[model samples]
Target: MALGMLKKKRDSKMSTDQENENEQNGNQQNGNQQNGNGEDKEKQGGGPPKPVGFLDPRMKHVRRSVAGKWLLTTVVLMIFILGVLSIYWACLFHVDQNLSSLVVYVVDFDGQVAPYNTSGVTPLVGPMITDMARSMVASNEPTLGWGPLPPSAFDYDPIKVRQAVYDFDAWAAIIINPNATALLYSAVQNGNTSYDPLGALQLVYIDSRDDTIWYDFMAPFMSSFMTNAQSSIGSAWTRQILQAASTNTTLLSNIAAVPQALSPAIGFSEYNLRPFYPYQVIPAVTVGLIYLIILSFFSFAFYLPVWMQYLKPEGHPPLKFHQLVVVRWCGTILAYLFLSLAYSLISLAFQINFSGGNPVSSSTEVTSTVDGNLNPDAYGKGTFPVYWMLNFVGMIALGLACENVAMVVGQPWTGLWLIFWVITNVSTSFYDITIEPRFYYWGYAWPLHSVVEGSRHILFGLHSRIGLDFGILIAWAAVNTALFPFAFMFMMYKNKHHLHEYWA
Candidate 1:
């Protein structure tokens, strides 16, 4: 019994020692965990755990693995800088070479036709200008598509010629009036002091259609051409009058009476069919459209958190993938509906006219206009609704693409995509594509181009290509809508598998 008792006591003492060693080992293990790099670090004031720095020894493999990715990122950025920016930089290269796109109709309505040729006198002015334009057609020099047509093309009516310009049938028209040579001969023969020089020739053009093209390209060319023609005609007429004076002393007495008519015997009447007026409309149609694009792009960022709320389910079950897509589509459209209204109101608030121009009772009156078809607007009372709808569609077109790209690319890469988006759109939209090189033809299908064109139609009472504009915008929205589901699916897959965690 004594030996058994001694054995039990020894077993109890050894068990106690083993328990104390286990307690000490547990304390050592807890202390080591608290001091670790990647291991959980307890917060002092009950906050969430903080992550270790990238330089931590525990992240050694992660650092090494991301090295090649960093190099790839820098290389891609360099390429993007050049590739995207070059699109805009090259937009206007050799713009002068495409001058033939601006077709200026040259018509001779003077003595060449019926009723005006009663004197059987050769019309010197009409043939002179028309022949001059035809000669330039074959030359390698930069020339307006100088399509010198007979008076029959415009029904032998100068009024019809003006109407053709107003209807955008031609960029400009140089019309020789029926009395061009008649007035010159009568003035010199009858000694008439009432000879109007501006009645000899007419230049009809619209400045509002494109200020850059008009002021920069078209005006300068027309100026130089008209000046040279006037100088030549004046010199020729002076020599003819002197020769006539030598034959008839009667003509010498008449020359002394109306010698002013022989100097600048003819002049061009520049009738701008539509002028760029009220300067305030410049922003409504031009740079303000850039803000419209920016507003649309940022809308995605603003509404993302709200949309993402649907991705998480706090009180209800998770939404189906397709249902979420519908949510995104409906939600985005709803947002755009309101946002576009706000944008349209900004133009309205500034009192940019939405009233249609007074209809010309006689199209010939356009040539007599002092300020070029005053008080012009596209759609009087109904303009606001149409304008709002245009902006709504444009926003959807631009914003949807931004969202889809951002979903696929994510943060830093999305920034690059925004730059790419702005450059491509601005290069194509802001400038006249007719003057741009053939390479920019694809810009016709771009979203901002449609928006800019549509805005001009609305604001300036220009041509009505709104149908085509809305069609393009809707097509863009439809395509981006189709891409929405796939982009979101990719995003979700990245989230589920932690694929974005690599670089994000």
Candidate 2:
């Protein structure tokens, strides 16, 4: 009976042990299932793994915002408005008022003197020319104004004068040799024997390329001097003729015998006086438009890279860079064309007297009735439109050039420096119109000047002189265009590493 009871107890203990082991195994299985479920949930919730070097979330948000676009547009528009204001200020008040005093130094080398003694003649002639210049200054009554240098001063030496010419002092120097005057006297005497006094004088007019109050002071002075010089020559000839007739019986007889010689010959006939300011409204307007269009193109081109950053992702996409550049240039060209046309339309609608008459007419008379001579053709009808088109093309090319340069520098802000430099170099105000002398060189070299001058010739039907200006403009365009592809290639090469690193 005791053996049986012990066996039962052992059996019971075995059964309990088995039950506990089963329960623990079931618990383990449940825990494993729970862990597996948790892992599945994590895998489902977490999403695909992000690749390395992802852009920051906040940065992406900022990039997507419209604020940047608005800011860029606003800045561009402000710059454009400023440029327009500058042109308007230069045209209306500064150019017109200062038109009369365009030329300041009139050196008359041709004045009457007693004999071969240059010493005696030098003092008299020098004072006489100086007096003529002073008289002209007195007649104009120019008010002093601000410039890079002081107003109303003349620089005499060619080198000094050239420097001043660049600096904007003394627009023109009239070097009149005594031989020229003698030729005029001889021509006048010959005309008394013939019908025409044909003598050409070398008027060395050093044009100060600046448009300012000093030009106003110089123009009238120049006009007066020219008139007085011609009159003086005519009067001198008359005096000589009368003296010969009075003193020489043979000369009087000859004069009386020849009706053609004795007949009164008309003196210098003034026709189509050159405008005081070389630049007029239409050309100025065209230039302003060109500036605006180019700037707009640049702004658009500049934004292209920013936009591209969003489109291009991962490994350098096939043809993506090429497409971006082409798109940029194409967009720039389109924008330039639109802006140029708009500007032209606005200018025509306003009927702003560009001095050559209606810019819209093709068969428009070249000469003004009152003036009765060929008005200085500011624009050569069809030529102006062609110039504007060419300008648009050039600006687009420039845009590409700027883009390539910006990419090469690896900084967009460098373009602002370029723009600043261009503006500084092109603007006449930086050089003193009255003090510095070499402003003409600066003027002639400036792209804007060519545009202005060339446009004038085109609009005014004066096609003859537009060649040089157009050539210069074309040369600038060509140079910039040639540099663009190389610059772009360099940028591509330089930034090649960044391409795969960031996007990939």
Candidate 3:
């Protein structure tokens, strides 16, 4: 019984040890499986799963849905860039093709029929000037189109000529003094220095705002005209003097009979009606920079709320539509004022001074005397404040319009379209909208063009259409301001209807 009892105890102890070993082995296997799973998960989530190339191969929809969005954006941007380039080239081509169609006005104050005229014709020298101008402009060699103003346009007054130029009746004024012939004859025959060729010269008043007209057309044509006239007059006078010195009465009488042959007398002067201010680049660059700033401001304003909502979830409730409008107006006014102040300082750096007073001459007299020519001058005195105010209001209107566009579009991409519009309207910068192609003529309605025109009118004393421009700008501002509330309502409706699914 003792041996049997000892054997039972040994068997029971061996059985217990075997069970313990089995449990240890199972636990080790389970731990190994868990480690393997953890390593697999790390590899899948944190490491590159495949070789890098154009796109990842392991992702759902090529890593994420945003990848598709990125691809679409790249393609669309490339297309837009190409389209903008094509439009710019088209504008250049348009300008090149239509240059000959530009019209100019001719004022012939240089009327003198001639001394010893035989046919009992009026010795008005204006007809001669007009005829010569017409003949030149009618040529097929890409000359500017010339239109001769009637004598009824002005009564031989130099001040009236300046006023006409200011009123945009013509691009330039050509004035021939009443005694132009007499002065030329005296200068040639008696070597009289009183009729200084340059001082007592025929007067040409030009709008110097556009260098193309002055340098390309007026300067060249007038120079050649003067040279030819002087040569012809000098030759005729020399022939007559030689004949008179030889006591050749028959030859002298013959020459005197053709005294009208000396009608190509030369003496001319030019007055720049709106002289190019030395710092014209300042105004131009200022406008462009301000436009860019306004654009950036509107773009930022549009997105800032979204960013705020994300970053400051508990900071404040969503801004109300009226609050947003008020904020935008205040921001726009402040931004424009700051930028304008900076622009004024920049102008001073370039020595561009602005003053206040009447820009036009007090006297409206046209005198044949040398000192009596009307002052072809620029008046920027009282005009600066008007121009600055117009530009300020214009910028504000443009900003509000852009902001309204962003709100109505309700897409971040509206910023890109706004940029495209601004670039396209730049055709107004170099060429007059009237001369630009039909495609670009829409720039006349653009807000920036009105601002540029108003600036030019006040700065350079152009024929100002400020009132019309102001009306347009104010109308745009008012309409856009009214549209903002509607845009907010639409955005709210969209968020409630379309975006609710994502929130849910």
Best by TM-score: 1
* Tens-digit lDDT string for candidate 1 (397-494): 99999989988888878878888888889888878888888899999999999998888777666767899999999999999999998898787787
After the best TM-score superposition of candidate 2, give how far the Cα of residue 180 lies from its true spot, in angstroms: 18
By lDDT, the better pick of 1 and 3 is: 1
Q: Sort all candidates by TM-score, best to worst.
A: 1, 3, 2
- Note the Cα lDDT for every prediction shown: 0.82, 0.47, 0.56
Give me the runs in candidate 2 sitting further than 4 Å from their true place.
1-214, 223-290, 293-298, 301-327, 352-366, 369-384, 397-401, 410-412, 415-419, 428-445, 460-463, 489-504
Alpha-carbon shift of residue 43 in model 3 (angstroms): 6.9
* TM-score between model 2 and native: 0.43
Model 1, TM vs. native: 0.82
* Residue 15's lDDT in candidate 3: 97
| Model 2, span 427-478: residue lDDT tens | 5323333233333345555555555555544444433346776676577667
Q: Considering lDDT, which of the candidate structures 2 and 3 is the better prediction for this target?
A: 3
Between prediction 1 and prediction 3, which has the larger TM-score? 1
Q: What is the lDDT of residue 111 in candidate 2?
A: 43
Question: What is the TM-score of candidate 3?
Answer: 0.70
Q: Rank by lDDT, descending? A: 1, 3, 2
TM-score of each: 0.82, 0.43, 0.70
Worst 10 residues of 3 by lDDT: 366-375
